[model samples]
Target: MSRRLVPLALTLALGLAPVVAVTTGATAGQAERRAAPSRTVDLPDGWQPEGVTTGRRGKVYSGSLADGSILRLNPRTNRTVVLPDSAVGKPSVGLDYDKRRRILWVAGGPEGEIRAVRLGTGEVLRTYTLPAAANDRFVNDLVVTSGAVYATDSANQELGVVELPAGLTLPPSGAATLLPLTGELVYQDGFNANGIVESNRGNWLVLVQSNTGRLFRVNAATGRTLQIDLDGRRVRNGDGLEAKGDLLYVVRNANNRIDVYDLKRNVRSGDRVKVIRTPDFDTPTTATVVRRSLWVANARFGVDDPETASYWLTRVDR
Candidate 1:
């Protein structure tokens, strides 16, 4: 793969701020005394993990593609614990943490189901099945907002939304609504909407097309989309997304790198400010930001003997 450096003048013209280092309150002497956390953490063999998210008290979570099992890892201590009562035959694609309810919303790939699992205990509170026709349905990724949880169906140009009531309780089964995607985005042969996130203070949703590497900004209420301009650059093989304020991280699985973009206030456009590449990455599919560091999961797609292959998470400093 070729690496092109964007000119500083052009980046500024595109409304992107230059990357700067964040300062800690500790002095240089004290900072040197404290040891940094490990950059890599191992997962169980044949885990085949994809989605990743962070919870309270520095807890990191990921789900297995092989068996749909959920695992919690403590990066500081390098400890891991698999949550019990997970669906064995299904696959867990994407995950989001609900702070208010202390639940983890899991995106069931191919099964077209959404599960709300209680934290620590892994007790499945509810399983909401999404409506699908004769065509295949893939619940690729999801994002949880204040009002609802929106999931992307990669095989179709629509989103599965599960509305949360005022009490923030889970609804009954088979209650997920399919919101058809309109406007600029068109479904292609392969995966369409892979990863999703909310931007511009929950007014707009950002989705990434895996095959085309294009980004779209969708209206939260209407589901109308508009293509985001990236100055003629494309994030080919984009798999997962992580957003912090105005900055967006696009994980390019095939490229083994993460593209960092500075999204504008309207969420319709952005500029790539940085590219993160590390030796620890091996087809990373998704990531979550924890304590100013990115914890990325290696899916290791197309590997021989996947049932016995090794998997791990790489920590990249932001």
Candidate 2:
């Protein structure tokens, strides 16, 4: 998270020294070699990306902390565009797209709001404001579900959930409800909840606590939660989370690494399979799987010159 919450959007200002790398799963024996699965793409230095997601045909999108905008990055063509919005300065911390409905749901920080926009057209259809609470609200990350949408409030202990009506897209008047996280999810210091994802089974919700680096499984229907065991190792500095099949990716920003996990079918626990590191990472925040690669948004929260600091996304092949 940022000074906006404590700071704004993301506060991963660890500013670790740069560690660049170059790796390809190749050897010089054969004339023909396997395609390399890792690379890096540079963004405008000040984009200050905290979230990343993918749409059809490997299209990648990142939300901005600098201007609260969304940039569509085309890896194949090396192009980027800021989506059209009536208000250009609203912060979008985390977002997910509903491909079936062509809806992009975004988390609005501090203001405690969620916006639903038409993906291709960049038209904001509805904005749902969650219930006001006494505690400060930092609407951090979110996942769009089959029947509803779930958003994590890092400044608070509960989840802001917006239930969708029978329609495929967000209803014009949908209201957001706060799902108080109970059971094993006892709130502690530092930004609590950050990245979130729906399990492959779609029966449970998976979340990462940024401060404690603990994973928790929540029953979608009940507010019940269970701490996901990770062999007693914490995923410290966890920011955004993304899951594909049995694979779960946890972006640990300050550590400048994405911790990969092989998940059990139940989604209650997982094993850290590998740690993906790229030289391009400058406190990378979140990532999305596109085809055979994972695209990460580098927030670069530590750079002194956010106005001039160059930002980029690391592409790691599967």
| TM-score per model over all chains | 0.87, 0.87
Give per-residue CA lDDT, model 2, range 3-29, as digits (tens).
Answer: 211132234333222333324564543
RMSD value for candidate 1: 9.0
For model 1 the TM-score comes to 0.87
Q: lDDT of model 2 at residue 42?
A: 70
The most accurate candidate by lDDT is 1
Candidate-wise lDDT, in order:
0.83, 0.78
**Which RMSD values do the candidates have, in order?**
9.0, 5.8
Clashing residue pairs in candidate 1 (N, C-alpha, C atoms within 3 angstroms): none
